[model samples]
Target chain A: MRIRKLIPGVDANLLIKDAGKLMQDPMRRSFLRGAASLGALAFLTGCDIIDGDAAEGVLRKISELIDGAQAALVSRTKLAPTLKESDITRPFPFNAYYTEDEAPAVDPATYRLEVSGLVDNKKPWTLDELHALPEVSQITRHVCVEGWSAIGSWQGAQLSEFLKRIGADTRAKYIWFKCAEGYTNTIDMPTALHPQTQMTFKFDNKILPRAYGFPMKIRMPTKLGYKNPKYVVAMEVTNTDHGGYWENQGYNWFGGL
Target chain B: MTAETMTASQDAPIHPGWVRICHWINALAILVMIGSGWQIFNASPLFDFTFPRSIALGQWLGGAIQWHFAAMWVLVINGAVYVTLGIVTGRFRRKLLPIYPRDVVADAKAALTFKLAHDDLAHYNAVQKLLYAGVIIVAVIVVLSGLAIWKPVQFQELTALFGGYDFARYVHFAAMAAIVSFLVVHVALALIVPKSIRAMIAGR
Candidate 1:
């Protein structure tokens, strides 16, 4: 009674009015009492809710929608945090769908990076030619979709500058990459043009090792680790999204970090 | 006619239609988010222990991500509507505000002793008010930390506030744990006071 006095919604008049009905129809009241859980179960199982393939489709649609949302959220001026050389995770973790030993072994001298689609220069690029392009170094975190992160010092040519050098159509919607290991991915044009996006040829000031995607890797600091394809052998500027490896398997296509 | 009028006039529903609708939707969204989130947590667990697959939703990491991202829109939009309507209708103020700490201690003592009067299903004791308000805040915290984790670089400042990309995962999990705790208590109370369930369902 003392505690009831402090309750915000307690009304003595309402309680008193309700008192007479409490014991009048005991059996019916007991049945109604038992119905509460049943009612909730029924509500949950209601036909209005979706299920099976229909539910999966809806979830897929929403995941697809987030790609647009992530695209909008991305800003060129806001770069992934650049870390000091000391901050680079030692022996930066090697990650791929396959084991590290199975990473594509490409002969650096013979490798040629094929460029196609909406570009004036459909010419394939050699490793020496890629090296000839101006280079910049960046130390940034590579955040994985599975929820681990590592910072690595990467050296490469700015992808945006390379696009200009290749005369790739800037209006193209996507920049698709194919790796020597058969890994494939497509990133949006804006992300491709992000200043920090690199067509990496070196790691820690050395020719990129096979463990690090070797011949070449396109590093997008703004994206998840999987989005950064290594052992890159071919690239195209196209309006078409030639669906990616993990993305086709239900991962968000954007994979924006 | 006279009997019907008397019944109608006396037994007004405690929850409005919008409140009940939002409540059920929120329940579904929260369940999906938590279940799938548990599965995602198990992929690269922060703690030593992992949630069992029996309790978690989604078969694997990719599937878990799809459900988590999918249900987020529903949770966020429904929660917004619930909060907006609660404030607009003055229900929050009338039902949950003026929660005195003194009353909370007294009410908690009564509850422990099984002497608390909850016969009035519409009126909330101070403890209930605190839990309801607190859970709302915790829900918001989870969403923000999730955003920070989802696009840590894009939302770097937000990530930094929660500590960093790695630590934000812990913040996200902690907020989820808080929500889960609230649900446990809330469900227990509903079962204990079964009439509250009817009040919520029928809004009476």
Candidate 2:
């Protein structure tokens, strides 16, 4: 093999001698006894080990299977563990692909939550109207895909209640979010209706700071940090899979973790 | 010597088919998992430093995650099969078990004093048995800690057992470090006793 030349000081004679010894080993003969059965099992499974692309396709299929299995296993009614006020991570670290200074500044006066797709009421909601609805608060952990977590109290209207008022088609498979910072993402409908899924407007009993996605952020404690959209300006309920910002780039769509 | 004479001399049964297959598969899976895990860890850079991108697989975080999850299935399934077969085939009892406290103490003394018993290359020594058993327990901890972090809400009990989300991450990272340490010792030992490496591969 061409790769053999890459090793600096390996003796070909010694290697050949080792191979000769291995072939002569009686244990090798016994181990090979099950080789026929293994070959049959491989053939029965219809796996083409020789085709590289087909192997990759099989891996992708398995990934999709895992996603489907995770989705099926998740309980919509189960709430994420809530934390005490004292447990809230102080100064909740700002996380985004960009630095803190680059956070998008959206004007509250002109900020309108746009509603579209698979909904009877397509009316845009202002900040006041969103706050007017019955509100809930939760101190839940925000789990990042990067292996860090922080707890922060978030106050917002229930996403389900908002969907109800907006006359969104609850039967839709996905609810997509368009953020002012140019981030786009989608979540499964069941996750959207999860009790902990909130259309958060307040952080720590105050107006959400710019670093924390002021105006609105979708808080999904049941999911990883990326699944939750910040600076959300538009939402679309639809059966089509819109795929998220990170998700489209190979992150699992069903990021229920 | 003729081929028949050579075959007769070298023909000693060592590892079974299942053990050899699972061992290689597990080694490959762990390597991929660790490399990709380093890439994933680079995203947030736990502590003040980041894992060097040059040594890690999957340059992008998303790609790293895909690799991690994919290799995770191999690790889980292969590990399960190996453990189950070890128990069912009585390999655990015959080969791994039967280590007494005195045997372990004597083995440790010999090992520390640089007097390894190389006479029985076919069987595991007391220290080898204990280390292997310890690694298996560590593997279980790694898997459980991984699940706790992966699905904290669903596996809330596991998260609590680890003390919380942050502590779970700590445990997972610590377990990975322990596995790496084990690998270092294992490779060193293999190099010291090349016959055992041949025995593992050729099963004699």
Candidate 3:
């Protein structure tokens, strides 16, 4: 009767019959015998349908738990699979919240990458100056969160190398990027230092086209496409959490693939 | 045992509460997963045509992913419980295992020609055993491949085992198709033999 009261709207007689059946079934009895623990009961109660902000808060906590678990599991040394040049998707489909024509056009002459926050250098580097840094290229798959993928060749300076050049605090928790299109995102320090996390300025062996985050994009093969900010014009390193556009919109903050 | 003994077995309790409860829960979880997965796939369809919006659970990609990830935990936990209990109770051995090659061929022929036996609803024929076994294996693969795709960098070894991220997706989609086909046959057979469904629900 007390259990029926706790379960609210359920028919008490039906619950009793099911419980009686469970007791008679050896397999079910054994399975559920251990489930009498308070923790299991609490978990089941938590999963019950509830109303309003309380339920939303529970869901958010679950998401946060998933994010923490995923963050813990990421490996710094693991690399996204790389494909051969011939394997690249020809005429790679462009994807964004906006159409290709709506892509922001930044004037190359005036474009300067500003570095600040937890960095010794607060200077701005022009496209030429950033491009002149040591270049590295890789042919890796760009995996979109939306269930499609495209292989493309990306060339740029390693983000870790660039971070060091800017005299950034390597121990900082996050490396946030601000793009010309008003897009902002952040990556963990380990991801920021990953060998494949590049400040990409070239695609298919040419200056990055406007369609593909021209001027510069953080080409993070290790992360989902959304985590890789494009047209990045400013960056900051900080210990405080700065949730990204999609992340703030309920997408997983880690956004690792 | 003789045919009489086999017939008598049908009257005895065959479906346990664990099996029945887990079965229905798994079915519900899988249906949610499939619908949400289709919604997610529709966001970036591999082929030209898109999955109809009517059958999809969540209208948007973000909402679909939430549904997917939520259902994923249910599927994984329920499936794990089923598998662990099956192995522990030796139910798999008693109900579906050691399917001989001869039995399979004979069963296949009998099934194709509509000569399959249903006198003992409690017992599994060689074909039924094989299908059940195959589905369990495929379910495990689907879960593992789903994990690999979900966290390629974290589960790098698992992803490498499936060849790569793209190949992992291929495997996941293919496994889903296999499960869907199995569901079709399973539901059809249940409809053809409504008694088995009743036995599952009431533990006759």
- The best candidate by DockQ is 1
| Each model's total of backbone clashes | 0, 0, 1
- Model 1 - which docking category? incorrect
* Candidate number 3, chain A TM-score: 0.79
How does model 2 score on DockQ?
0.17
What's the ranking of the predictions by DockQ, best on top?
Answer: 1, 2, 3
Pairs with backbone N, CA or C atoms under 3 Å apart (clashes), candidate 1:
none
Predicted candidate 3 versus true structure: per-residue lDDT over B2-57, tens digit per residue: 98897877556778899999998898779868877876777666455556656665
Per-residue lDDT, model 2, residue B59, is 46
Show where candidate 3 strays beyond 4 Å: A1-60, B1-12, B101-121, B160-163, B192-195
Candidate 2: TM of chain A? 0.78
Which tens-of-lDDT digit does each residue in A1-257 have in candidate 1? 22122112222232222223332444212221221122232454534233435545666788888877766767745689898988888867776655566678999778999999999999888888999999899999998777778888889999999999999999999999999978899988988999999999889999889989988999989898889999999999999999887786667998887
Best by lDDT: 1
TM-score of 1: 0.86
In candidate 2, what are the lDDT values of residues B14-109, reduced to their tens digit? 787788889988987897678777767766554555666566655445546766888899999999999999999998888889878898999989
Off by over 4 Å in 2: A1-62, B1-12, B112-114
* Candidate 3, residue A13: lDDT: 44
